[model samples]
Target: MTQSMFRRHFRTPGTESSSAVRPLRASAAAGPATETIASYLNKRLAEIGVRYVMAIPGDYISDWVETLDDPEVNAGLVRVHPNNEMCATYAADGFGRAGGGKTVGCVSTTYGVGALNAVQAVAGAYVEHVPLVLVNGSPSVAQFNSQRDQGVLWHHMFDGSLTDLRIYEQITRMAIRIDNPALAPDLIDAALTACITDSRPVYIEIANTLEGYAVAPVSGRAKLKKSPIPQNTLSLDEAMSMVLPILVDSKRLVVLGGVEVARFGIQDRFRQMLKVLKAPFLSSLLGKSILSEYDTPYFSGTYNGRNSQQNVQDLVNAADVILSLGVQETDFNFSGVASADFNPLQPPGLPLQGSIEVRMGAARINAGLTLQDQGELYWGDIQLEAFVGLLQEVVCEPSGPAMQSLVSQFPALAPVQAALQAANGQLPNAPFPGLSGDIWSIPKLTPEQYRDQITWDSFKSLLHHNYLTSFGNDENQDAPVLLADTGLTFYNLNNVKVPQNGFIAQLAWGAIGYSPAASYGVKLAQMALGSRRRVISVSGDGAFSQSSNAIGTIAALGLDNVVFVMANGVFAIEQFLINAQAFNPQSKTAFAPFTRVPETSLWQWVKLAEGFGGVGYEVTTNAELADVLEKIKAGPPQPAQPNGPCSGSPAPGCCTFAPDATPDVRPSTFTLVAVRNVCNDLPSNTRWKLG
Candidate 1:
């Protein structure tokens, strides 16, 4: 079943090359040109309602980019602050994640070199079912035949660079080379249509020189509006018959969710389903904190720094039935199994008993409980919401006592409490001379210590719960606070329960640097909605470095929030590579480029904050963290944060700020101008010292 899904829908570049194509764009059949190619492109882009173009142009794209810069074009460009093709592609991928299925553009110079550099990111988008419009500039169409002069000897150019015939076909829905300037507009439209309609990346290559070349007649085309996502309807009788019995008979039932839950906008429906059944639920990193992140009885905590996979499996194996909503059998999820019962862990000779019911989209399976409802096939964006409604209509109480009773046997485990108590009930003093420890840093204390900290009031203390605790404040926030990027965090999180205003995460495409970019968008969304909720981005320092420039954006916006950076130098997930090669005991697993940034210079981070007109502080222990947060909450907001172009400028849209000022060494060398207030915007007269 999985192979069929991967094969039929996954179009390779070879197939596209062999298939004949027709143009759907406007170009003068045989007449004088009127509009510049750049003008025509801008007009077409505007026609498609695309205003944002993200890129770092090479010489090939300089003309088109410069054309776009003209006031006449008015197209917005997000000059991604990344050093290489990989990160650039990541920013574009992040842009798509936040853009909500709209075409978030990725532009690069022609030749297979640049395109090849971004192949991994493009592959991620394709495999994860994310839509990305990739525009690559190539050498001029006229140069395709001549093998002597320029392109023949060009440094980055390859013999068949214009048509990266070998690779593009493997990862994209369609890869087309626009050789005829006249046909480019139509080709562009077709490629874009393919991208949006198929919800995957499409490659449209334009000769570096042909980009925005004169087009006698510009094609009048509408940007392709994705068809309303088709919804897979289920037979009420069959669905209820299958699901109801599990609800009425199972004593230890659980629900699992993933990205599709959010993609389909069914978080609320998921919440309703969980509530009606009172089943303990768990979320994958892809589905982390969808509803909430604090503590909740239903949160199984199967994902995260601690491997709760066994705990999750225990519940699934023990239950008479397991219901999965929008769960994909991706390797990172479900350990590549359609059902946990079928997983390798059961005694080799032993027979498994329970069933796992999956209610999801088009992919098929021969699992214990399979809902082949075509509604799942419907690719409409609203399916999540629709699924929610369907789930609500069919409900049942727990088979017997609520599953909470089963969990009660474990009692409230307290790692932090025991740690504190054992340490004579005294917390370590602040690491720095003038701050307190951060209580939030204690994610792995002894079990007894974890149990001691348990309390009832959700508002006052950390609940003896899991990721599901962040849900419901329907009136205020509609999301979760914790936003984890596609680093170690994405794989182990699930059952997100964010408040109405709480934002769980938007890294649907499994790309790194997503959280950093999303942080800005989420904060901006909150501000636009007039919500004052505190936003938090808990990311690996590795991911933070990917879009570290965003720190400038945050500071500039003066977003009232915090970024809890996990300092572990390793890419946590890489360790799990060993799992992929189960047969090889000595499989070397390590993150590439094992370079470590000195821990001593984090003050530069503070400088980054101050540079953008915000406050920055460093802490080493939990106690100091708690104290700073207290001070932050109590302190007044800073003076208006200085604005930069595209975001947080004092004026509507000023691009005045730079992540690194002139010398670009200020942060690494500068010290706090003054520590007057941890929350203060750098007042004009503030002074600082160097590290």
Candidate 2:
């Protein structure tokens, strides 16, 4: 196809006039003879800087897997084998997040069951704006054509139709089934570009027969390019005109950064903007760690409506003008119980006149001109970076004396600033006995300080203290931490300090067992980026059991990430709510017995971890955990290289973690620190009502 024709065919919708359609980089051109479609796909992935492809092999995709196995065709891409398709996809998502969109994550799965299993992960990626390339192997072209013509059933077919592709379409930016090998390169290139430009997952279904199909190599200049950042000068000027006047007039201004700032790779730019604006700033829950809280002077704290600290809430609520960047108005973002009149899209109410929201490709301004009509201005297709850049420029122009005078009219942000300063002091540092704060108030608790038996609160307190004492400092600034599940485990860890871009949690989706599977991918991505930070995963017993099989992947791959399982012997979050809402005074019955589980009789996670080819430790008190932490600290360092099957040997079978006659031996060591806790015990601040 001609260059112009190719560009026209693949240009993303709504970006027709965007400057993102520059000519392909010189490195993308073809080299010599034509290559097989599979080889070309791998080359394209490498060219686009994808370092790994998380995968799970199956019958339909065996041919493609073999092609990837070929040393000549594999390029520099490493194929990672997760225990299941779900873990594979989650790993890809984690990789994308950690790489900060510079390196796209890829996952390969067989058609039907394999592809279907990855749908949940893909959906989460979609919602979170994570860029991922999902490649699925389907029936051969001949088989597919025959099925289309005569309804022949394939081995993995569900409903005797191509349902896999249909299912992914809803959760991906682009979904294409390659029926013709000749168009394979073009299709893959288009999907990859979309994945990058939109920051969402894209699905590509390659027919098994097409792996070896020969096609003309793409020329060096015929590469896929990300859509240019649109200027949108007129829209930007219009929006800024409406916003700056109000901003200049306001006395109290606050900047609220959200997940989009991180997703769009604009953390640095956002930080610069905050510095230039010189306003107190806070982050939404998802936006935490977009910038380091410890370093930013004006960073008040995180805000979640009623759930926020009284000081944080007062600071945000009292702002006369608020500039929110890339914030999504989710139920959880607003603490799930914000006032009915609370409109995150606009200012909370009245005198707080000017509110500005800059989204991925949209901008909104509320001038608060009238009670009935607040003179809200909306503009679409405006790049968030460009809008913010222009806004910063306009706000910081040479004619700033008037703006400075207006800002000086307001009282110093002392109340909010003092509160933040106090909170900052409470933040744990290298020293063990850091001053206590609202949530982390207890002085570094030791196992010896507690009674013989460990309760949920004591265990949680000990874990929090250990994490702070171990990694919460400038020296360990880049340590990676993962929080699995959405109950007390997440709640406790959320309050802990994490390095910038080092925390991973499915908080928005609240998916169970996400952390265990996702931690594997996070560690892989960390290694790919040449980081030596030890990965730490925290999970409740219920959530850990859901994806505990992933421990095998860790052991088989020789990854040394640490996982802490809070063995609470129940779905504590569910039971907490049930007890609160369904208590029967007469019958003295709380809820069904199913809410609880036998502690020792249930799956022994410590033994399970041992079976998975990793070391296991059961800690019942703070002292025991302290000993475990010291051992971990003194343990052998992670290998400078990956020693898993992907390095050389054949990949092991699934369920390698299961018990066997002869115990499986592995090179790597993973530790399962099982903290025993009481079933009904919960943190004091945990509320049980739904919003």
Candidate 3:
């Protein structure tokens, strides 16, 4: 059969298409004999556009796994087995984030140990506001009843108490346990609804005995519709009444976009607001790529308090009024390590006094006006879409001549306009000097120097060069890039322009080793959705070593992804912080010894990649780096053929004991590029002192 025909044959009955799956409402007329709870759960997952479930198998979940494994009952949801529960959960988080917060990523783990292992990953997802459904298999009803009623013990039980659900409550938006099979459908719907509405991880514990139990057919009212966001016209009017004047009267108006802009899927609306105001905007560190730097004319630079570019700082600091949309003023988002002395109640340098801050579902305005009382206008549960839509409607537009006059009034507008023009002409051959901004000050180095010396500046320049020259402005063709948990990588790579919603970073939670593990899930989602974008995972040596085992899973699945390891022999960010803080070298504090990460001679990443059945390259210079990037941009690598079906043995081209015998027709290859760099070399312009 043709690929299209094969897909159609396996498509679920109620889903519109594989790419846009919508859940089907339960039919009360269809009796309990229609389908088992396991099948119902799988179908629900398919309805939510979950193309894959990243999971690790355990005895408790074996029955559910059997249902997932069965082609007839599994629908189109593919089950991916990762090396560990942590990797599985991280991959799910990546998948959800890459879907622009609409797609709900699913993961299944066995109870107790499995669920506990995934808590850290789920916590990261919670803080980052990525929606995920964690399906955990619990003890059977009989086993649980015996434990509770007869004081019997079971394997994986924690001190004779089912405390797993309690543990998850702290990290997830909802922790639901399906004790009665008849209420399974309602409970499942509640959990899924909470996951979608809140855009955070939710936990659902399915008793092993309930898998085959007959549940009441879902009511027709269960169809998944867009969850309603409570709106108040009076509050919206109050917000506009208070902030609109300040926005119009201010000489220099600036917009600071944050991660919620992307999480709420309002990039276009936010950009429209900028166009209406005709003002410059800067993205918060976590909100990088909320708007495409290349496509948006007014995008200045990323703002992170003291660590921001001097021009960006000057513009924002000097602004008459600032409008911060969906911004969460976290320590890292504002001042990074310098937040030690930074006050959260007030903005740095009292910017909040003149700022209109819109977050969650409320707008707070502080115009610094003498007679007005600064207060918050609550919009109930109104989402960013509705809020931005209101702004677009109410915002007054200027005539062509008036806009021109307004543009000419601000002295800072010239640099922003110049930067936009320069960015437009920044082709591969464009002179580095022509790029006129503090952010564009890339180090000029010859090819020989690029190859001979791998300094921090040179590495960043090469990355920016490759990204700008190769990727261009075509977001359609570009894949999402995942940045590991390290300040060095994030600060340096901030200059590289990404399309809106094309960058993923664990900024708020800052979990190390997330990039490599999460890249697998991101790539899997992209492939399932029929996107051709390549997955790029960038990690520091310290971060890479923590999740190096993920390379095996990447190779095993034959995923076409690239892992770039910045092999800077130490935890450079920590060292930089220690030095900047003037921590005593002889002191017995944890920071003293922790700064020096022990070097390992045996930990050759390239060799480890080869052992995991992937091609590895050690890039010492720009020349070698360019070659590897060229190959990646060209296409995915050919699939390695397995020696035999389900054989747990190593083969030249195939993954051992691979679950899917049918190789991805598209070329699938993995590459680990180890870029050697100086141990203590920090990104230029890094500010480590507390504000």
Candidate 4:
């Protein structure tokens, strides 16, 4: 029987607990094996919850990859081969992100050639605080020892056998070479533990020789023990004392939710605290959709410093205490790179007024995992997980004397204001009357009228209106995830209302072409959890080309995702950065030859999609786009991911093999939609201009 009892429920975004390390696997308590390094490592992987190890196989890693498919050897963990190393790494990243960093995404590749391709994506994971375990196969121990001593160069090797590990050392939290059988268990366990505890990627190297090497398994129960995270109690108490009164007495409070809420696996607490306190909440661009915007009261749209509506900015600036959770100054989006007026703790270039001017900005208070009270001295290392939990309890459950006393002083704050409501409520002197004051609902246009009004803003406005009215607002269900690739797409990511647990992006890393492949991995994770929510990925032409092969895998597997390829024929982001004036109406004629996509690079999206075994559509008008979107939404139930062996027919045109040759379980198919091309005179965002 499967270990369904241990099927970890990594809480959906905007929800969860602190003692959270989850694994998505069909596990079982298999007894200790005969002790080959392969068996031991695979057992550990199973225990840690890696359901699939995404990789592009190479000679050195072939043996390990093969062993993974051997159920007896791997305890049900499978080896998934994606299009390329970049795609594999992205898939793994998506898998981990979907699980809220509680479950780790594992990858394996060959020594040098294959491992190098993964560097950029792995670095992205490192920067984003994503947990992943990268396993690379190396030359046999004997070959490495003899060749290195004889000064011989190998096929996929650089200076030395440990070269790849050294390179990865800079990116991963742990980088170790497990050359000997005796050291495999501890080393593997340590690496996996670090991935989860630190919420960062780890690198593990296993030589081809070690695959079958006999090793003694750990003596007793095989589960690796989690490292006990100790917190500075005195400092935690001090921080609590300092923050409570400010929070309790504040007249207008706002909870500025951020990416850390999901990364730290504290979404539940964050959402709960927001409800109990009835505070207005705003998600940063990178943090959008972690919570549902539809039913959530007091929820404003994404906050981008000065880009926000004047009233939105003022609502934040005027807050007596703005609790900026999970945001740091290091974010390029806020570090004067995207805007000069993005600082939230000390909001919008205003001078501190009145007495009691002690600002506990996260930059000053928290250092990575350690949460401090005030100055660096009080940064006695109170762990964030511990601190957030304690804070949640104190705020959400105000039964304690101190908490009750504090709660009694604060008045109940209402949620998101109703439409057409006066601009004088929680949002003082607001220009508009909605959660997000920016949404301008547009009227539906006929085919003829849409011909003249086929612009970006028009389409966005119409789409949001359609989606808001079409989908059910069930707070309990997981919503479709929107994965935005880096480009002009970033500017429009949060233009519409986000459903609960809806929204995924690598914005901080800003990797173009990530969303396409990431959709594959996200679908895999969602399938494991029995969720059939469609993954909507938005990609620019440039970024989409980077990993368009991801569509092949998605189609072949019968996965359900909608890829909206904004067929902009050039790297618009490059033009924007090289000459900002190009975006202005006065400088619309500005041209940069390098930014123009060559004819060879442009994809006939429909042909490409068809060749990859998915339905494709090209829409140039508002009417066409709207009709296609509604048709997709109203289509048949998205096929559920199969847990058992592959069964049923593959998606039509997905495969040409004999009907009974393989029953690969692909119950549904993907659709590719090509929208209006933005080659010239594209949409521009003044707020995101270089500060």
Candidate 5:
């Protein structure tokens, strides 16, 4: 089909509905039992509570996009056009994470170019357990078949037929192509279910020709439900038998919670189990807000194996029994803390002295490359979802010897706030541990007290003490929801208290550009879920520059949010690693050009922010930042014009909003604040730092 032919499929927004896809009613029983494959997939997505399908327009995907009429295919599956394919994927990821496992996020993109751009976001979702669906539209079956006959191939294709699908198979829970329209609906259902059950991204590719191909309607089919974590009951019982006995005899049993807690929608249950057992638990890097820091007194800071701060390590070392609940087996998590800690046959030898490790799916205790045996103790589906509930029953219901053992240890370990006070920067802690923010007596430092010029290293003390207090204003309304981008930003947030389920980052993937775009999706999901939280995204300058296009949506929509750019004019995180020679200090050199991040002086951040539809502040001095921060706290400024945003976009000398002509009042908008820091101060803790 030509461009004009495809354009006819999408009617203007207010005009007649797209004739390309027939309407799908809520009660499909009254109508035909079949609908187009495009309608079927859209309905399925809506059934899974996917509110927004972030997409980018492309000829390959236009047919499928036309079928996405709200309440026609299904309600709640709105199409959102993002700045780019990458941002669209990131936004979907953010939505999925923020929805608390109750919803899924979908991304619609075209063939190779579009799908490849989203690779980083999808991989991050897989590693950190975020629910997502990537719908890719490719060339028609005729085009694909023509290529096999040695005819003209599509623009983005190689001679290989399954190349794109092969790439996605490595990252997603399921990667399926719908060449057979008759089977498309069933495949989509299975893929979506896998996305939810596995808490990972899935890919479904539909050829442009097959999108409108008729398939049996799925409206009368069973709606999505959480499938059971397929574990043999007897095997789980046996696994718990070996695990519970150690806990019964131990006095200092510590629970090492991880990302799976929240990912599986069991964080609340896990926190309750912790209270019932009177166990002090430390969250993993990805599970920083697994339990509310202020609410849970026994909740210690994040634990990233040997990468933990000295005090946190001391606490972990003192534990008599360590139960790892769904902790990942990544280098970032373990940091080469000796083979004895994860020996397959034998339990961890030291530190904990006893280790009980289990995950959401199966229980295995082997390092990735140097594994000897399978380490399958009782390997049925041993997810935390099933095990945590059973363990809570084993300890709480019957006041057995195990319960007595747990009781003796409580009120003994000092409360987290007390430990935090003693810590004094030795460990991460909630910035304000009380409801009224009175616990730490964090002072609001005057701007003049700090020097205007300092390296990134020198800015840490000021950042930790002064900046974080401006966030998380109260418990409910205007509560801060953080999207800390990759780099030192994640570490900084870990040091502060993240509101319950408030921290969203692609930590496992360490994709620098993720959070900035994702913050948009998060806000969108938050709006759908009826949340009243303000998103506060802090990103490194390099990371911000990578996906700053997403900022246009956030600013144009006028979301009352704050995005802090840690502007140091270089990829400071990598620079730090280079300074320490990537943790091998012996090879460290003095300002090597090849390794050092070339400083960038061009591309003024304020201009970038303004052009993207928000007011911006470039601050070299603390006072300027303080002034901008004050304006943020004071709320959106009155527009230069009365009833509308005179321009909305900030320009040359003054920040102005387009007018409804009241000269003094206009619409509210978001602000971008860039904190410019001096570069090249090597940070401490070179060996896999930043929990």
Candidate 6:
């Protein structure tokens, strides 16, 4: 990428070091010097670290089309792809998760279609709190009120005046539309600022006409300062009054809205508090993996866990006082929304007035509600720092018995134990060399074990991405990055556990297929941060194939980490749909296609990844799969060669596993007794143990 494609870093007044800023003399220059808005915009983009923006050309953004396509202005700074807005935003969001810090800008022509298409991914970023900047090329500023009358009726143009009204109110943290060309630079600066501020999504609408309009040279004066942590603005006395009481009096309290954990850089503090209070902790989906460093049994709350859904809901509903930090009640995070919409008067199997109603017990807690100063039930002003001063002053018992007690007493080991026993069913009853013990042992290893067996060491945390980094001496080492997609992989992360630095999908936007392209971004960010950390991304079968084309980009880059595809071949989350349909006969929602996946067809993905010069493998069963993972991990670091066949591509005979590879080994009565004993030993103060 060339320097002119992105914004340049601005130096403050009196610190100017570049001779390029020397005033241009009218007499010395031949005629009037001129530049188009596209040139200027691309120039600014290159100034910052942004080199590539993923986008598909649209009618409204023709200015950028004319600009980026210009061989002269966009040389090195811009690249375009022929894909939809979802893929483009997914790529950008993936880049941000890789620790780019700077929001990767995404562009689209304006309308309900473009914005709505991007919304699912953008909403993923919003919910996951991933930093993304979306720039919509508005219809010409001159045509805003007149376009409908010009008889320039086109498919993309609207009869109504052009405004990004749908998204203007729905998803972004801050949004702006520029009617004047002069303000374009400021709008760009502000949009970037808002994206990094609070790590949220922001939107900017630029008129297509603004592209070629000339303006004075940028003064370099328009830049944004970081937003102060919201908690800092709260009065110390008020926070003390509000939070200390809850902490001191409540026996079952736990923190929610784990965003504050990042804001205060206080995962350590959180660990300390959890130890002191001996309270169980539950994080909103955004807060999943918030404290990767600690493997406290307190980590999973009832609602967030696959098994503990009902228990967690009950715990939250019954708590005398629930203390939240930086948590807000958004519709997606709130569980109160009805999953079913059945008509009460209609009989079973009869056509109901509305959708048939069936409610999942998990959807009851509204994380969005706020505790106001006046005690009113409202939402706003949710920040963790407000009570930091009071929090710092409260001394906790360092070695509380509560921690040990919770570890001992909470005994729902049945499900996990059952899963362990079921592993034997997966393996063949053969004399396998390493296939020696209970089936549960197969998946028992923590995420760190997976990392250790493979020599690559990058980890990206969902919250800060850099949490697992080394100290000062090794600070320059590249981020060892791994990207995880949404599914059981991320949601069940608290149980499986991983090193702190691993980045998981936390996109507030909740869009799928994000990890694949975002893996490229993670590699780019690691490079920019001057770290040599290897980048790996793991995706489910559905998401991996959704944006499968990114496989070519990965091979083109030859980034460090292996892209592992866990091919279950179904959208697992949609099971709720099948469940609702099965339970409620009157319900009309059809079950998504889960049964028709060609099991043999999965190997094609390996071939695709290999075709892109990435090492790909099809590990159908446990035999030697661990060894393959180890070899990929130990290989020398090199960017993927686009055309080179992946060294790890599954070969004939090397890829076969017996039909009954995994064998079910039931847990003995002795093991169950032991587990129960461990649970019973926990202290009474532990959140899992009731009086």
TM per candidate: 0.59, 0.80, 0.83, 0.80, 0.80, 0.60
What C-alpha lDDT values do all the predictions have? 0.46, 0.66, 0.69, 0.65, 0.67, 0.45
Off by over 4 Å in 2: 1-30, 339-355, 366-374, 399-443, 446-449, 452-461, 469-478, 576-594, 597-600, 635-666, 688-691
For candidate 2, the lDDT comes to: 0.66
Best by TM-score: 3
TM-score of 3: 0.83
**Backbone clash count, each prediction separately:** 89, 9, 1, 7, 13, 79
**lDDT tens per residue, model 4, 1-691:** 1333112111111112332432122223434455666677787876766778896778677666766766667766777778888899998888888766456688888989999999999999998878788889887665576577987666788877578988999999999898776788788889988877777899989876456655666445456644536765656656665555445445666666777667667777667666555667777777776667777666866665544445556666666555666753333344223444456665334212211211112222222212353333234455556666666666544455544433344322111112112322212222222333543223455556655534556556556666544566845454577787876676654546667557777768889899999888888877765666678888877788789898877876787788888775677777866776665655555758887756324667777777776778888777778778887777633453433333345555453564323235465478888876545544423334533
Query: Which sections of candidate 3 miss by over 4 Å?
Result: 1-32, 217-219, 336-350, 367-382, 396-441, 581-591, 637-668, 687-691
Instruction: Tell me which of candidates 1 and 3 scores higher on lDDT.
Output: 3
Instruction: Report the number of backbone clashes for model 2.
Output: 9
Candidate 1 lDDT at 676 equals 16
Per-residue lDDT for 45-80 in model 3, tens only? 777767788878876676666566666567667878
Residues 137-230, model 1: lDDT tens digits: 6655444444444435443567744446357778988888766667866776676666665556777766654543455444444445655345
* Residue 559 alpha-carbon offset, candidate 6, angstroms: 2.6
Please give the distance, in angstroms, between residue 651's alpha carbon in candidate 5 and its true position after superposition.
Answer: 22
**RMSD in angstroms between candidate 4 and the native structure over all alpha carbons:** 10.5
Q: Which prediction has the highest lDDT against the true structure?
A: 3
Steric clash count of candidate 4:
7
Better of 1 and 5 by lDDT: 5
As a TM-score, model 4 comes out at 0.80
The Cα error of candidate 4 at residue 270, in Å, is 1.7
Residue pairs with backbone overlap in model 2: 20-227, 20-228, 28-220, 29-219, 29-220, 30-219, 30-220, 447-622, 447-623
